[model samples]
Target: MVAFGFTVANAVAAWFAHYDPVNIGWRLMFAFAAVPALVQLVGFLFLPETPRYLINHGREKEAQEVLHRLYDNDKEWIAYEMGEVAREMRREAILRQESGDEFVLRRVLRTAHVRKALALGCALQMFQQLAGINTILYYTSSIIRSAGVHDKITTIWISCGISTVQAVGTILPLNLIERLGRRTLVLSSLIGVVITLCMMGGAFILINYDSSKINPAQAYIGIDMNSTNTNKELLDLCFGFRNCDECVTSEYCGYCSLKEESSSLPTTFGQCLPVNSENIQHSLYGYCKDSMNNATAYSFTDTSCKTRFTALPIVIMILYISVYSLGMGPIPWVFNAEVYPIWARGTCVALSTFTNWTFNLLMSLTYLSLSQAITKHGAFFLYAGISFIGFIIFYFFVPETRGRRIEEIERLFMSEKEITPERNQRHEKTVSASVI
Candidate 1:
């Protein structure tokens, strides 16, 4: 439900961005988030304190009252639950006393089960980021633009579609987790992610290659290539054209003119003038040099290059987000919380969360730079490779904790051979019998 709400917010923001004239639509979207935050604050004020917290703080009468209210005045269940909570609190106190003032981090590091849990937790978080979901989430507009979507409104709408698919995908795991199990869901999700990322990368590669073929001439004082002669000699002449040393001849040469008085005038192509005139040196194309200052020098002729794969990239992006939302998006945190013992669970989960945020920050900050360093296609290919590696790691090292108690999970991780087929069969039988 929370993920659904978040996607709805993204859709609304995209809608705002589509129609915003001054480009401040994204800012307005962020500003609107305060509405939900304020509502949550007011809601929290009216919520009653939990019975367990009251019991732990020595407010026994309040704890009993809250328990009775929670159980709808069912004295039997309330008494049983209160005893259980008190016993758990006593056990926790004993564990703390045994640690004898040792730092929680140090104690966590010393315990084998806790240490392994922390390692797996951190690795899961890191792998989640390496899957490259943030790349799409943070730069959806730029990515769609690169894929040949020129209209801002179209790009934003496409992004909203991707977010909607992601939200819908999350629903599957809610019902499937207990039946299909964590390991299967995560592995399947990663496989889907790898395949979708490869397809997206391939689509971009085709678009970029076609774009290059259409516009071979570099952005020199932009000259329209379609209007120029196609002969090799003429092409070579245009390529070799240089800034004039002086404004001595009647021949036209690229030169910069003063800033145009009107806002609509083109800036790249200025009026042609002789070499070294007061005009700025702009380009060497004769036509550009001869044209008026406001003339459009060279509008990109390769607008059609992306048309072939325009829908392809968007489809791939939606598929990738859909696959990710299935299990990889939420299961890692679930596993992180469940794997640790109660005494160290909080610290371990905090460290895992820190790892997630750190990697998320790294990916968001470096995505643009990496895309420029290695073309967009290469970046996605690299991410796909990382996801493949993550899948292998999870398959071999991560254990399924479905239907298992924390103590059982700890034991499974502690013993090297505990995940063998024989042990799994025995564990399943035990769980079945317990349920019966």
Candidate 2:
């Protein structure tokens, strides 16, 4: 449901970007953000209060009514559930009293089950970011362009298509979570993530090293290179590079190539020169400039080069988004919400959420610098390595929590004796009846 909003948003923004006059498409997109926010605000007014919230607030009648409907008016089931909630509440109150109202973090740190849950939650959330979803989400167009997309509008639409895949891909999990279970979904997702990242990395490697992309840059091949001595140092800043691939290594230089007829890769000798600050798509002043009056026929780009492997990122992106939506996209949030006891839920989840955002910041901040330092394909390889580790860790550590109650899930993190025989028997019966 959350994904649905942004699914439509990308296409809408594309339309606005293509058609809106006064160049206010971005402003309109920003304004349109409120439409969903307002709709959700109003929708929440009609949402039913859950049994836990109603019971916590002393709305026993409402809680009973909710449980009646949930458990199909089974008096014994309702009684059991109500009693469980009440008992958990009593335990929380007693803990609070015994701890002398210590900080929530301190309490969580002291509880064995919740501490383990906290560690799992934080690790999952951290890897979720370390997988580089944000890097793709925030810079899909840039990546697409690197994959050899030339036109701005085409890049926007392609990015929109990728987001739509992400949004639509989430629907399968909604249906599969109960069937396949959470652990299965997340583990499968991590495995696919690692494989797809490796595929993407390999595609980039191929693009970088293809023989057709090896057009060496001529230091003064273009007619626009003035013979005057005044700009000699400036010329060296760009012309020092020997090849099209290395030309972009210098931040100031843009690669301008004459593409071959049969291939996407540039063939003829190209030149490297200072990129135009005013309009980076072309050279500052050279044969490669976008102006029609230029002497040489050149395709100028500061950011990305033409390559045959362009289709690979698109294909890999779809696969990545599809697998990601099935698990890491939604399950971490789902699992973290249910992992800890009621008393520690808020504090521990907060820490997990903090881990999420901190890692999000870390990934976003480091991506550009990392790409520059190690090159883009190298960074993708590193992310693939991290994702492989995530797959291994999740397979061993993350438990299957389908149809399990919070107390049962809590028991998963504790020793066997902590689960009373009576409670275990009841839980077994419950699980046998409803294997959701």
Candidate 3:
């Protein structure tokens, strides 16, 4: 909430300072934000630490005191809960240290089930990050503007609103998670996401193909749209157009003809053409530079496409919020932390963390290249395809973790048994704890 409030305050302030300069509204908005931030800071200062953590860390006396302060009437029950948590932690820690001789990496790598869990956990993280979700979240406004949204400010605000809705709607899952199984939640969310992504792809296709009707605002390209003669000669003269600079015109003449003739517009035509016919043939591109002058050209406006359900973006945004909340929001931690046996849990968790960072690094370095090489629509389409594959793999392979104790999952992997007496005992022991 603090992060959200801070972001909103910063954006509103910047918007006001840029667009509503006379009113000094930016100052007021930031000043208002300070109130809640200050309140939160103060409130947090007085908040008690979780007794569970304290007990796990061997601060039993402190944990008891905190529990008593938190629940005066339930002190007896809380103490029993804290005792169980401490015992579980001690058992796990001792077993881990004993097996590894120092809780080191060598022991984990030697175990087959542990290695499998680590690999799967790491792969899950890699897949999630590589799906290109963050690129959409962080750059939605720029994406909309690039799509020819006329009122850039409004588009930005709408993006912010959509983000706010996503954040707000995510809290619902925290309430509904226990009621709905984890597999059910994740599967349903992914299915919804597939639908939403396809819709977005269709919208892009709509905008790209029917640009004359949807986003008629033509991109301004350099070079004269009406020039009778191509600028090939000037380009050759300016910089050796041909592979060989044998022509006398290629050398600096008294004045440059290229400067006089070159158009000031931006072109989708990637490179400055050489005088040779080969360069012209190799140009390999086509787009309407003349569309800027077309009267039928449409600009993205809340009012312009109003009757055509221009509101579809907003509706799709709501679906995005719902799908993300149910799927991507919870799946990472749930997958990486819960699927492995206790013996391999730490190793798998570490590998998963590493996988997330590695994939993030790859994405950060390659996003621009991907966007340029395949176009944004193509890149997102690829991501949607990858997500679809992940959805199918998970539906068949991922087990439901909800309402089941971690030790029960451990038994499934290690003992290969279905709810035996030993597994039930392990489950009962694991569930008696209150550790976070």
Top-TM-score structure, candidate number:
2
For candidate 1, which ten residues in a row score worst on lDDT? 241-250
Q: lDDT per prediction?
A: 0.70, 0.78, 0.56
**Model 2, span 233-307: residue lDDT tens:** 766777665555456645677787664442543356677878877877787656676674643456777767767
Candidate 3 ranges with C-alpha deviation above 4 Å = 1-59, 69-74, 97-104, 212-314, 342-347, 414-436
Candidate 3's TM-score reads: 0.64
**Steric clash count of candidate 3:** 5
* Sort order, TM-score high to low: 2, 1, 3
Compute the lDDT of residue 326 as modeled in candidate 3. 74
Error of 3 at 353 (Å): 3.3
* lDDT winner: 2
Measured on C-alpha atoms, candidate 3 has an lDDT of 0.56
Q: What are the per-residue Cα lDDT tens digits for candidate 1 across 319-432?
A: 898889887898898899789877798899999999999999999998877875676788899999999999999999889999998768877667564456785675465444
Q: Candidate 2 or 3, higher lDDT?
A: 2
